[model samples]
Target: ERLALQALDRADRLGVAGYVLGIARELTGDFAGSMRCYEAALKLLPNHGAVAGDLGRLAFRMDMPEIAAKFFMHYLQARPGDLEGVNNLACALRDLNRCEDAIEVLRPAINEHPAQPLLWNTLGTIMCSLGDGVTAVTFFDETLRLAPEFGKAYHNRAYAKIDLGDVEGALTDCELAISVAESAEDLATMKFGRATILLALGRVAEGWKEYEGRFSADLLEAPRFTIEGERWSPGMDLASKSLMICAEQGLGDEVMFANMLPDVIEALGPQGKLSIAVERRLVPLFQRSFPQITVTPHRTVSYEGRVYRGAPEIEDWSAIDLWTPMGTLLETFRPTVASFPNRLNFLVADPARVEHWRRELENAPTGPKVGLLWKSLKLNGERARQFSPFMLWRPVFETPGVTFVNLQYGDCSEEIALAREEFGVDIWQPPGIDLKQDLDDVAALCCAMDLIVGFSNATTNLGGACGAPIWMLTGASSWTRLGAQTYPWYPQTRCFITSDYNDWDPTMQKVGVALKARFPMA
Candidate 1:
């Protein structure tokens, strides 16, 4: 530890004690310790732009995004011309979920440093995050112009083009990115992007091959499994080997693929043991849904645990040919709506809860029980496709004998009050139901309602699961495609798309008309 003290002494002499200590703490895997050191150093050298930037980065690492944003802004104020400061500040703002503010902060720096490839690339990422893929594509193109070998920029541009429905353009960008990618991570990203684009364009054969890149260590880092003696093929596999199918992506993906468990079992035959690793919360749902498979409750593979000799782990199955989740597999085998699963039996709400909601609805009126969700998810890339709060359900609220219910979460008290006061409509909202609560109640509420209307969010997912008749207002650049009225997972749901990138009026108008016709009151 003498060497460590000498390093600290050197850092103190350079007036960078905080940064050095923070770095040392981070290297030792003591994130909380690093944060404290950074905080202490900031107290001594408050106006040091570089130290402030490092502090902000440390806060971000700790997931204290709001604090990180504050420090990043302070760093930018102290050193306005520092490119690193500007970039870090922009990223912090983005993490704090101030996407528009992040864009505005980067605009001036981008203008000043037009030839800086990284700046252009960052600007592109911010624009994409803000749901402005059309504009993001331009920034990404500029990044490529400045640095043709920039693989990340190409990969990002492909994502933007995909959002804009320029499938061909996205494919070209992905190909270019794959060619220039040096690292396994970059190559996997490019490959996945290409696979998604190909699947969207209905090019299944190539898409499935590229989609296998998700299994790579650079992507998931999860162990692959293979049985010692077993023949595996597309149509026939009579192996008694245990196959562990782990959830690789988001919650929605897990839900989507859960419908295909029967198909997987069929492919492997009765002798094969099918084990699945999924989120802990979903364990109950999956267990209830599929009794045939052994459901494992593990979100991620543990790298530190001692290996069990008897039981088959994910690592042992690496040699067995793995397949992508149901959606990707369906696309590869039969890239059409006709092949969609018809036996999707989503769990219904508790009978008592459903009956209680039904009684409440019955006592109110003979009018239409309407569920309203105003806000869209800010975390997803398609936030730009969402209509303003005021624009949503305006026409529907104007309709006679329609009771509007608030299904929105978070800080929506103002919006709830405004809707009640301005429209003279009853907004049904229960007490003690905050964002922390699981969506089970919301699903039950949807079941009680005559119709559910909302922007694309968990509400839609909940409504779909309960088999409630739902009208979804979707963004133009949404991951869910256009002209697809029905989602395979939710047979009872219908989607309404925005005609333009940011316009919601037309979609809202259609919803109003549809609601009026479906449930008319005297």
Candidate 2:
């Protein structure tokens, strides 16, 4: 930084100085500072500059795919033949759910630069995004054949292999990818990939160790978390320690990982104090469930293009002895499938809220009240590939002696109407409670249901956490199963998995048959 500033002062090149500073700030996780520097550079060199490409990638890191696409397009116009710009623009389009358009953009680039392994690898990623694992694997093979040293291609092929139910093969590729990975990004990605494969294959101890790689990847931009001086390791003693467990990742993951919370508290012992920082929406439920510990809401703030997470609720950070990400507890408490306790659930829902929902369901048609969740709210091209289409749930709805309750969040009117009009299934929507926002009440509602069946979304995890009987509809490659047929975290939950997401008819039919067998027509 000193030398760059000295050079700028000597040459009077403000744009160059700003660009250099932006790169430095971004590398150090100062995203807002980086954006300010980049914007200054943009003002100085608005016509055409490398700053445009930097802004495009910065936009992507911040989760603004639309802005990312625009910046990448501008960069493409500035440098038409640049493979970096072409590949990034296509990736932005892919994230924007414009898969076909992304393909069109890639087609021309691939035709012109037939020898470019980067282009081939990007095409493979797009294919994986589209759920064509076989086609993706073929493209990855071509990429590796062109450049055997491309670690990204190896890591990408692992994704395709996992989708094709060759988890062991996927793990092998991930190991190979890590061996030849030269860049930090490629190495971190391969480690994370290996973690997913290991967890899916039921190698829990190794998976938890590899899962730490997430902090090295995109989460490097997040605020640093500490209790007193450092993070708690796998086998750290908690007898006289004060530990803060901050939830990481998505809401569903927080709920799922909370399966280890009870064990963590037990390990802390009477002399030890434990504090937890969780998603704000889960504060009430978590506090109620773990009354022995302090449950505070985690702070998540967004600036220019970065998300920052912190436990600002802690009044005395220095007083705390140790801290760890919530998932890290699994590394200590649960190293194998057998390590998981045979408990029904860890989280306890509001008993009054549970009874209230139960009485409300009693007023419905006299049969078993079954909660049905068919999709996640964030169903984009990439995420939608993981869930079954609502239309395929026709068979499950067709089963008699079950009053289907609407547990599917988001704007799912189309699905509810389709079930009623086409499948003759009238899904009763519980009044007054916001399925997405009222998470505490949602947990109670889940507890009230005779059975809750859905893909592994936040609601399903909540249901499973509270010991509600959950039949999760997932693929054979679901890593959350931890190489077990059932969710060891929630012993009450049953997994109904299919090998193919392309055709969910057979799986839906199986669920329907199971539904009938469980609740035959009265």
Candidate 3:
């Protein structure tokens, strides 16, 4: 790369040299530098297809889909015969939620280059995005048939199979994906994908260990922990040791992984001590729940399009005997289904708030006080498909003898209003609670409800952790369920696993039936 840059001293192939330098910068994780070099290359040679394609990919990775799509379109215009250009353009279109446009873009390429595995793979991905898993599976099958060594197709097939209610098939595909993967980057990501499948298949022992691949440097994503200490591992001496467990992942995942905290505490013994860094909002809750363990809020900051999590509160890293990402503890403690304890109220909410919510529920004239959370606030990409529409929650709202409490945090006034206008049901908003900001009080409010029903989110996870009866409407083969009908992490859990997102109406109907049976009408 340095030689290519020096070649610019001769003023020969200046655009190509700049492009080479861009690639070199990209390889070294200097995306901003890469962007500058690529832009310079494109500015020098307006018709450079390779530079355009690379710029499009980088833009896509940086979450600039509009700019990416523009570049991809330019690249395709310049190099119409390139199967890669067609595939990339289609991918960008799909990211923009222009699936039909993506299909139109891909169809000509697949027709022109019928044997190209990537074209077929792109088609499969687009179909998967459309919630057409059956069709997506077929496309993936064709992609794999054309090129058996193609790793990404196998990984994608696993994802499609998951939605098709084929956990066993997904697991098989995950294994094949790992075996066929060529790059360290691909292998790391494939292993992480396999972990989800293994856990979904109830193979917790292997799943927990493989799950660490998420933090692998080679993987083309960032959820990196900035811990400054000797990382704890399985078989580490915990007795009389001072350990720090820094939380990882999203709020729900942090809460779910926290099932192992009590085990860590007990293993540490009375002489030993523990400290934890959780999400800032969760500091109070974690401190109250685990009085024996010191709790501090974790710091998360995004820099140059990368997320870094750290526990900065402990200035003296040397003071700690060992530190580990909280998720890693699962490998040591929860090896199998039987290894998980029937833990209850592991996250103790504020007693005063709990009593206050209980009194509020008591004042309600009749029927069960059912707390409801339908969808996650962060509905990005495929996640938007995982949740049913508010209109589809009709049967759930139709349930008799139930006063629905709106536990959904984000601006759910639209849903609340719809329930009143369409279903003649008033989903009551609990007073004095800013549902999103007041997560500490949310736990207590969850505790007060007779039953909490929702798709898996931070609040439902909190409700489950606090020992509330949570009927979690989860996806089929959700790894968090650990391949069980019951959520092993929480003591009080009743799962309603939806096999297909396209048809969650029947599942919601079942939930209504179950709800009616649990708390029959007057």
lDDT of candidate model 3 versus the reference: 0.87
Give the per-residue lDDT of model 1 (tens digit) for 351-433: 66667788777766557778877775454333443554464657788778877767776667787777778877667765444
TM-scores of the candidates are 0.75, 0.92, 0.92
Q: What TM-score does candidate 2 get on C-alpha atoms?
A: 0.92
* Per-model CA lDDT versus the true structure: 0.65, 0.85, 0.87
Cα lDDT of candidate 1 equals 0.65
The clash count for each model shown is 9, 0, 0
Off by over 4 Å in 1: 1-67, 107-111, 114-121, 124-126, 181-187, 204-209, 212-245, 265-284, 291-337, 344-352, 376-390, 430-441, 480-485
Residue 209 Cα positional deviation in candidate 3, in Å, after optimal superposition: 1.6
lDDT of 2: 0.85
* TM-score of candidate 1 against the unseen true structure: 0.75
Distance (Å) between predicted and true CA of 47, model 3? 4.7
Give the worst 10-residue stretch by lDDT in candidate 1: 302-311
Per-residue C-alpha lDDT of model 2 across residues 224-318, encoded as one tens digit per residue: 45334588888678886788889988899999899888888888888889999999999999999999999998988776445567888788888
- Clash list (residue pairs), candidate 2: none
